[model samples]
Target: MLTTVRLSIIVMVLSISGDLFSQIRNNYFSASHPYFNYMGRVDSSQREYVRFDWPGVRVRFRFTGKELKLYFKGGQRNYFDLIVDEKRMGVFYASGDTVVEIEGIKGKGPHSVQFIKRTEGEMGEARFYGAAFYPEGKLLPWIGNSTRRIEFIGNSITCGYGSEALGRDEKFDPRTENVLKSYASIVANAFQADYHVVAHSGLGVVRNYGDNQPVSVNLATMPQRYSRILDMDDSSTWDFSSWCPGAVVINLGTNDFSTKPHPDKAIFQRKYEELILKVRNVYGSVPVFCLVGPMIDEPCFSYVKEMVENFKLVYNDSNVYFIGIPTELLNDKDDLGADWHPSYIGHQKIANFILPVMSNILKWNY
Candidate 1:
């Protein structure tokens, strides 16, 4: 009798375990699921997973669940912000192949979840293998993309480098680089638009920040990098036909002028024009706003203004316009982030400065 009782208990336990395992399997959803909505430049070539490195890339989904788990594989350590039902829950880090869990859900009904990449592409590429939910849960249709689209091609400013840092003196750490807080993201959000950020810290149109090289030998400049889907991989050419923006914002020249021995002024102008031409080549007369900064003034400001004017005349494209953000835009004492980069507050100010120009040009309200 004792042996029989033990056998019955063993079988019951195994049966329950099998059911749980089967339930988990049933609840798993692939990253390529049609219900998943992705924003920014993402490579979804793989059926099982989606890869992205650009900061501000977002994946959103709605599902009926009380708990959620995300399966992600990171090329290196990367951080992402979790938003549940339009509220930020927290930041989560992923490395290697890992499962991130969000439990203690308050409701039994369907909930929305969004993951926004906080770090720039140079930090690492990440692959999201999709999400798993509670046994009874399943994915629902995601909110569709916005009709308005904007593309920002810039440097560290667009990347939101150090936006979350405690102070201006603080050094840059990938954990504090929240691209969602950058001016590019803020402007896009304000306009209720989808945005793609093609930016890298210290990169420029010709000479990178603190680099003395001439234009001929300069490597990995914005023009070259802008066409890439992945920041770190040069071979991953982005297909422009897949996505096009209603407007393009270019904020370069800060890094080029950050130090002495800047690239030749003529070369800088030529390269800058070339970039605008490249944008026109693919996008076809989209409004291109060439921005000068709150960072460095004078030469960069003047250079960009002249370049845009010449570009309009030469290309006979009146859609290209120049907008300058004065140096006084940021309060040096309170608005500087890590290593004197723009803090979240600073980025907000920048966005405000550009918003009106964009609104008037694009005829977009709000």
Candidate 2:
């Protein structure tokens, strides 16, 4: 009788384990988080560029020895401070990965966590993972979801630029860096879609003071180093197999008009046309919107206007559009947040204007 009772207990335990495994559909150890087993066992592994950007909350969950270290990326201002699972923790940026260890969490059970961040601005980009796993365990099955992905390609303005709104000294002061509250974050929140931002400060399609590279007197205005996405190589970086963006919003031309002399007007026009063609080549029928700069000047502005006319004449299709942002939109002193980036309010205005246009493209159910 005793032997039979022990065997029954073992069988019941195995049955429960099987049920738990089936409940989880997809799980993976985010390269942004410390390595751990599904059973909640921590393993030391070098986490890669995993990142999360939300407002007022930034967290990094990693394993260092038996302890779980929680690294907090700083916030805009100490409006409220960060609260995780109802506990307060200090925040700091991890130029590299900051080591951390978690305690008390164990097993394959579900972990529910809530993050509360204060107002001055929040570094909400906190990401974590459980183990080195992927959906379907290395088998990427085709998901036939007719979903539209949108990719925004541009410069620091695209990157949130003046979102920090701090002075030059305060810009990188380590006190005001919050990636979570950028314009991309704001737009993504509004769109409720997967968004990718490929941007850098002071980078232009043609050569810029930052890059310090001279182009042939001949080649068109340097396309915003499209090849930069592919390690400065032209070997198929823009392929959109898994992430075919349905529409691409191009917000460049800002840095191009900097101190650098605008490329010969003709070259500029051709380069813009060619860039659009290349983008369409990879994305196929994806819609592309060319946004004129909020600060485009006389000659450059006229040139862009001409280019828009030429592109429309050539393509003669609605798939490509030049969204003219009037200077009136730029009249607000608040538009220039910092380092020539749009302020939070400025970004909102842009979003408000673009939202209707984008919703038209996305056919959002209003």
Candidate 3:
């Protein structure tokens, strides 16, 4: 009788353990490592559609619990695929949740997890605000798996407008709100890196909004937004120690060239010099890629490139490099997005050119 009772107790304990294991499985999307970004945008009560300040290119997701569902409704013909830990999970079409069997390590816990999503062509840009992980019981895991950190500096284009819906007037697709699908955002995804943006609409190194003020020849030429200088002065502005990136990409010449009557050539050069010095000081020993112009026309492109190269030579810093997008890339008839932003397909091309250079800088094989 004693032996039989002992056996029954053992059987009960095993059964309970199995049930608990299954429950845990349903609650998480476990893997070796997991990481994701928050989709930045807020919705309004009356407008059904939310206003997105940035484009909805692609968002990263990391989960330790069970499943993930990407809810979207921008395109009907669009297709996508998810890659986790360099393994192809499967291909999925637009507007659906593609499930995968998350293979997690057995005993020592997961080492890391990654979710890479890609879209092709110009069906419609996605607007992503945040991610929803199943079994919402535990806090999302943060495994420092980022291979590179990128900072994009540009204008409204960099802000990620028209990547989603048009504005109120019909100049573009007013139906959709701005999503997080900007070209820079997409490029960051292709490389699986952390990215930050320091761009605004109609901003220049010497002037702001619309070049309302004349360019200054001395320290006065620096725009208020150029406060990155102050940040560098005090470490509190940015702790490069914590996020010392391997490479930095600057895409600013566009706004500078767009300013009318052209900024005083001399002032522009001086401001660019100061900007480069500040960047060099903060990110010591890191490569800085300065882009000339995307759709920036004629003499302006040559002017900016000349300044960039001359500055590099002056500082004797081999870390500085320059590239030009040329008119060929902007051959697409619709260069003017909602308020002159790049569209979904436009962003993909931008990503193609910029990603390669960035990869080379970071020594990424892709």
**On residues 1-366, what C-alpha lDDT tens digit does candidate 1 reach at each position?**
011112111110011221332355668998999899888888888997899998888899999878777777655657888787777776666466666666667676688888888888888998887888785789998875799999999989999999999899999999889889999999999999988888889888988877766552546887888889899888898999988999999999998888878777898999899999999999999999999898889799999999999988987889999999999889876789999999999999999999999999999998
Error of 1 at 136 (Å): 2.0
Point to the candidate with the largest TM-score: 1
Please provide, for model 2 over 1-366, each residue's C-alpha lDDT reduced to its tens digit, 9 standing for 90 to 100: 011112111110011222332343443334333222111011123353322332232222222121122333222232222322334433333322222223433332222222222221122223332222211232122222235456676655565655557443225222433334555556655766545554445555554433333332332232544533221223323434545666788766665666655556676677777888878777786778777666555555676678767877878855776666665675446565665556666667777777777778768532
TM-score: which is higher, 1 or 2? 1
1 or 3, which is superior by lDDT?
Answer: 1
Best candidate (score: lDDT): 1
lDDT tens digits, residue span 120-223, model 3: 21333333223334444233445554767776666556655555534223353323223246777787778777765555555567654355456533322223
- Local distance difference test values of all predictions, in order: 0.84, 0.46, 0.49
Candidate 2 lDDT score relative to the true structure: 0.46
What TM-score, computed on C-alpha atoms, does each candidate reach? 0.91, 0.61, 0.59
Candidate 1 error regions (>4 Å): 1-24, 216-218
How many clashes in each structure? 0, 19, 25
